[model samples]
Target: MAHIASLSQLQTPPWASVDGQLVPYDGVRIHISAEALTRALSVFEGVKGYWDPASETFSLRTPREHYERLLRSAKLFHIPVDFDYPEFLRRLEQLAAELLVRERDLWFRPTLYVTEGHWGEGTRATLVITAFTQQKESGEPMRLGVSTWRRGTDVDLPTRVKSSANYVVARLARIEARRLGYDDAILLNREGRVAEATGACVVALLDDEVVVPPSSEGALDSLTVRILERICHRDGLRLVRRPIDRTELLAAQEVAIAGTISELTLVSEIDGFTFPVDGVLARLRASYLQVMRGTEHLEGVEMVATDAGRALVTS
Candidate 1:
């Protein structure tokens, strides 16, 4: 399966929600002098709405969890969340309904950012919700390489907060890896311990147990990683959190990357070492997709509305 090489390949929807109001995607704009654009003073959440063909419904998996993380990020950055969780959820559902996304999975990006005024000190925060349909992943395993750049430590920056500014470091590493002929880059913390891939949490299979780097080790407290932990526990699989050394990752039986957008991507190679795609990882991915599609019962996932629920006009 060919990967989505760039954002240019994605077709943006005609409509988007700005501050809970539906507006034309082309018309939605932020000030050029906004702090979010100038200084990257923003935090956002990437959520997926899985379309269920059997039920003809679209279910947003663990939206509350994502919203909670977004709120935590806002608090960390001192960005004001003027609207509550319920209102945000309602607006997301409304945006999906307005888009009339009938049998395709959709992606939702809800961002909170600071605006112009006072040169980035105590400025008011703004919100925007953008929803669009995207092609599913090709299921091709990614080729990763160890990055020369180090992940930001807690002392340097809040590793747990999903700040837009934090991604610049990962972006540089990814660009370097692409230049060296790799799909993605794996970052190690200052202590030289395995941190994570760009915007994704990593788990390795070792000695028949699934092990992941702890949040203290510069790994983002990823919601998808937590979901995988729960699924592993329920299935009688051993899942543990421990500091993984760079050498340990190279010798692992298999490695998998989990995140909202990546969605349990299998790693075929890291640096020069390669590992086969394991069955446990495949099972976990299948289970996750089932839960996301509402075919399997899972907590924290809900179907807000369906295509048949109401009539909508996209234009």
Candidate 2:
């Protein structure tokens, strides 16, 4: 396992990419009156990169998928991306090289925001790509609780689009959970069906089957969950998608949360109900790590080291 440090412990890198240009991290800035700040007209993606010691390379898992999601989010928010997919990817790879990222696992936040002075629609869009060393927390299971706050429906805000404004609801629940000494909170839909955690998709093992809530139930269409589904199919593990209830989660044999940053985190307790770390969860977690590090290959998922990343690793 990579040594994970806390965000506070890791120092910020010297460089970041802004509008396709590499600049000093501190040099990158947005005006205080930017529309994205005032109206929260921003969409972003959190992508993970793993450092493989065996190959001396850094593998970025599914960059194209992340980029495609960002584009979808931009379309939903009316934020125009000036560059095409290939051009944007090339710039990101350049930024990663400029940052000199090598041996450590990394987290990249690629944000598209409205930068025009006006707060309403038809504003100029700006892209900022920032990469940071990933800090892995303890491998211990997380303690979660069901939040009183309900997730927004499609009519309220399209949950599938990862808009910055949409996260405020989850943030409130997270604050309440931390105040109560829980690791995080699982939110329910308006109809009292299990939605998801603040930033992750929830999964549970029930009767020897892996089950998750469908995206229609106010959950984000999670890439991590899709990857898990493929792993289950390959491994002969049963995977089911359906509406889950709070009581069902409480009665589950095991529960876990999957996300780009969180990866596969086991939920040790929920609403005082506890579960053991079983072998199935362990196998899935191990398989995920393998897939991420390029040791295990899956179709439709690419884990490649960028030229810039390779240069840094070699240097």
Candidate 3:
């Protein structure tokens, strides 16, 4: 894809493939049964890799775990991917390095889909890996709003899997919210509880406690959420997962959302209520910076830091 000046610069990664074979980023052919393709029978995971100025190397936040989650999504959606874990990781690493440019951030995506087979009403199974980059957002606080749309429940669709079909609703919600003059939308669960932002997990501070909707509320299991939980624990903040009412947004002292694309960002306002940009959200953002930059690691997470004259090596 050509880099449009107004948008982020994105390039095809050399390591990306389709159906266990290397292909151009966009060349990956997705073979889905007509029924499944029309009904959105696909599972995908969006991940981000960071390029450290100090290390001058690109590092995936949690490549293996991310793929594991993707695998789980595939299983949940009845999709199949015929590739070993080690080879998958190796390919991803190769792609990340080859795809990196002068951009400050790189966005990576790996998708598992169903090939042409119709078992009942769904799809057969296949897998593809696609990756690209997005320009880093200048540090700016977002003004959010409560979305009128509710997240699709497991009863409605397989909420546990990160399926492409699941995002259609979210995409529309976000588009409508932006038309309403908000940066994003916070989806409520079927029970009208605050669940998550369309593409990100929502986190807010209530009574000095970190509150996020439990997975039971229909939020996607976000890798970014795990990172935030770790940061909260390290900072001595009490992390609580429970249902949050819409009114709680008013009570939230600090509000933020996390995702691979956005990472950690502060919400400056919701529904006209102004919020302080400097608060727990800011602190967490700073801590995340430290962790990703190789200054610190959250015990088990890996940081890709490179030494002088060292480049990421793959077999």
- Best candidate according to lDDT: 2
lDDT, model 1, position 137: 45
Mark the 10 consecutive residues where model 2 has the least summed lDDT: 1-10
RMSD of each: 2.4, 2.5, 3.8
User: Could you tell me the lDDT of residue 191 within candidate 1?
Assistant: 92
Q: Give the Cα lDDT of each candidate.
A: 0.81, 0.82, 0.72
How many residue pairs clash (N, CA or C atoms closer than 3 angstroms) in each of the candidate models, in the order given?
Answer: 0, 1, 0
In candidate 2, position 239 carries an lDDT of: 87
- Cα-lDDT of candidate 3: 0.72
TM-score of 2: 0.93
lDDT of 2 by residue, 1-315 (tens): 122123424667788888988888878888878888888889999888787778777667888898999999988877778888787777667776766455677778899878984645557888988887764343667898899999988889888899888899998888888888888899999999999999889999999999999878988989998899999999999989999988998999999988887788888899899988766887798788778878898776777677765687567
Q: What is the TM-score of each candidate against the true structure?
A: 0.92, 0.93, 0.88
Task: Report the Cα lDDT for residue 154, model 1.
Answer: 87
Ordered from best to worst lDDT, the candidate numbers read: 2, 1, 3
Superposition error at 315 for model 2 (Å): 2.4
Candidate 1 residue-wise lDDT at 311:
43
Model 3 stretches astray by more than 4 angstroms: 1-15, 31-36, 120-124, 136-138, 304-315
What TM-score number comes out for model 3? 0.88
lDDT of 1 at 186: 93
Q: lDDT tens digits, residues 153-268, model 3? A: 78787667888888887887788788998888888888888878887888888898988887888888888878888888888988888888888876788898887776787888
The model with the greater lDDT, 1 or 3, is 1
